[model samples]
Target: MFIRLPRKLFLFYVSVFYLIGIPVHAENNTAPTGSFKSKACMECHKKNNPLLIKDWRSSAHANTQPITDCVACHGKLHQAAASSSRRDSTCIRCHGGKKDPVVHSYTTSKHGVLMQLEKRSYDWNQPLADANYRAPGCSYCHMHKAGHNVSAGIRDDLMDKAAEKKVREQTRIACLDCHAPRYITRLFENGERMLEIGRKKVREARSLIEQSSVTFSDDELAPARAQLVKMQQHLTNVYLGVAHQSPDYQWWHGHPALDGDLLRIKGFIGELYRIKK
Candidate 1:
């Protein structure tokens, strides 16, 4: 009942269990999906081009779950001589739309507008020291120093709230390179205030919707649902479009659209209430 097996015998038994596909450990640790352990990229790039490897290794991309290797961004058919001008599209593939709402907002921002007008292109491998480059691109703010940490120093309301202060401080330091500290601070504070007001309005609309759902038929409730969706889209536009530096969107598109949607929601609620009475 208390026999102590020899260490060699114990090791041999563990080997047998493992070889037979029986798990000895209780923990179900598995690698993330879309991840690979192959060092094929590093094996070649490390010696031929050391700096590239170093840059990637230092980036958040290397550390994040579902870890990305060169193949993730560059595609499986990547060649050393392949043109890097297409990286922006590749970035948008994962970061655009609902995947990252800020990126969606950026597409409609002034910078995006100018880029489209001028037919400008951004290549991450290229240096930005040229004076001809008038506006900041995605790489300018997020990928400075060719750093892979896309969210570095960004103050995203969608991200972790606990880190907001630290992120804001870091973002201020980044902004100080081009803007006055006072201006940057005011801009960020205003953005926060705008986001707060938008959130409150959305909450009020949602409350009205919930109350309407209790009495209104599906056909009657359809317009309310449509208005609520519009309200959320405008609120998101306000929050993210400001952060993306689109003044016109914040004032002309986002704010006005949100106000109209809120009114529509209120009108729908009043109509439903009158019907109920």
Candidate 2:
């Protein structure tokens, strides 16, 4: 009787071979070759751990990609794999880098901060799409019925009025999963007000830059221009802080920082005026 090595185990050996400079000629140049059977995975896991199988069945992953499987995200060779497979990093297998803009913005938020602090105590076996975690992580909020659509409730470019409305509606629905309707509404209203204030600050800075630009050469106005760029970035941080419910980011890193940038630009413009006179 012959025993077949699991697909993940076989791939592990293949990698070792490559490291040792040994040649390999895989028939399909793929990990899931002819001998690998996803059914084999189900048969054993169903008997051993039916709850995990059930979670997978209910997930968008079940009906969708072939990549969303046992060995695909979780790999082989483990002490039953268990909750270890259900990490945020596992989502990154397909979702990509920690530095990804959406990922970065969220990580800097209160939700992400809480998740980072309390993740060790979380029930990793809980269904992420169902919002079963204590604090919402990437999968908890974004994993809709359609699968990992990270941009579902996100309004990165608020200038797109149509998109803003759509994303606002979606964001409301997502927030309602954990918060009161009144609270969500109030937060949205406050965020809009804050964003408007930030925008006004930016406009004031732009007018100053424009006034200086009219009299001075581009080279002369370069310092003010650079400060304007920094102010814009700080304005964006304010937007992120509002959206992400990060108070520290909203005040200290955002509005206050923007104010300082504006002051520097204003001082530069004043000096330019003195030089002109």
Candidate 3:
């Protein structure tokens, strides 16, 4: 006769088998992505350095992008030797690049130059409150309230109606503290108009480039490609320069260069098409 196992024992064994199998499936499914450990940093800082934590919590860095943790700016070894002298470099890591027009514009702006000059004489360890800083840095305009939201007034979302309204409102509030309401409004309007013009020019240049690709040979396309790239760079520079409060860059380095590149591209397209005909 076959011995009957108790129902409880049978169910217990089945449950253990399923439990063991589930983890193998789950491990494959739940592999880690590169997510920041911001909560861990916050938890530790909140207890050990309450004031610093408070400032960071209220700033745009903590509020906006979750990935932008203490390690993002301060680095992994910040606890041992955190210094404000490295702030510009740390910020530039993300902001000041060839592709990043906004922060890159700041490096060529008057404020950026002044900040660089002041840093030569200023002490990194000195408290910001006590330090006689000459010009505004990235933190001065964007992080006025020790805010972490760098995108508060300087977002490139003016094309969207809802985003435009929100950005304009935020920009107004931010500008009013340092500038008159009329001046701020005028400046924003002018910048917006210039950006629209720049966009049209870039689109025209790109269209010409596309046309050239079909009409011209690989060797002939090199110059067109170079001009197109230069035009795009200038367009981006001008758009960001206006927002960053650098009229000289907007006019001299940005719009003028863009216009020249656009003209060159147009000439190239015309010559290529004429030769094809």
* Winning candidate number (TM-score): 2
Clash list (residue pairs), candidate 2: none
How well does candidate 3 score on lDDT at residue 123? 55
Per-residue error (Å), model 1, residue 99:
16
Better of 2 and 3 by lDDT: 2
Score candidate 2 by lDDT: 0.70
Show where candidate 2 strays beyond 4 Å.
1-86, 90-110, 158-162
Ranking by lDDT: 2, 3, 1
**C-alpha-based local distance difference test score of model 3:** 0.67
Residue 171 alpha-carbon offset, candidate 3, angstroms? 3.7
RMSD after Cα superposition, model 2: 14.6
TM-score, candidate 3, is 0.61
Taking all chains together, the TM-score of candidate 2 against the true structure is 0.62
For model 1, residues 168-192, the per-residue Cα lDDT tens digits are: 6655654566678889999888877
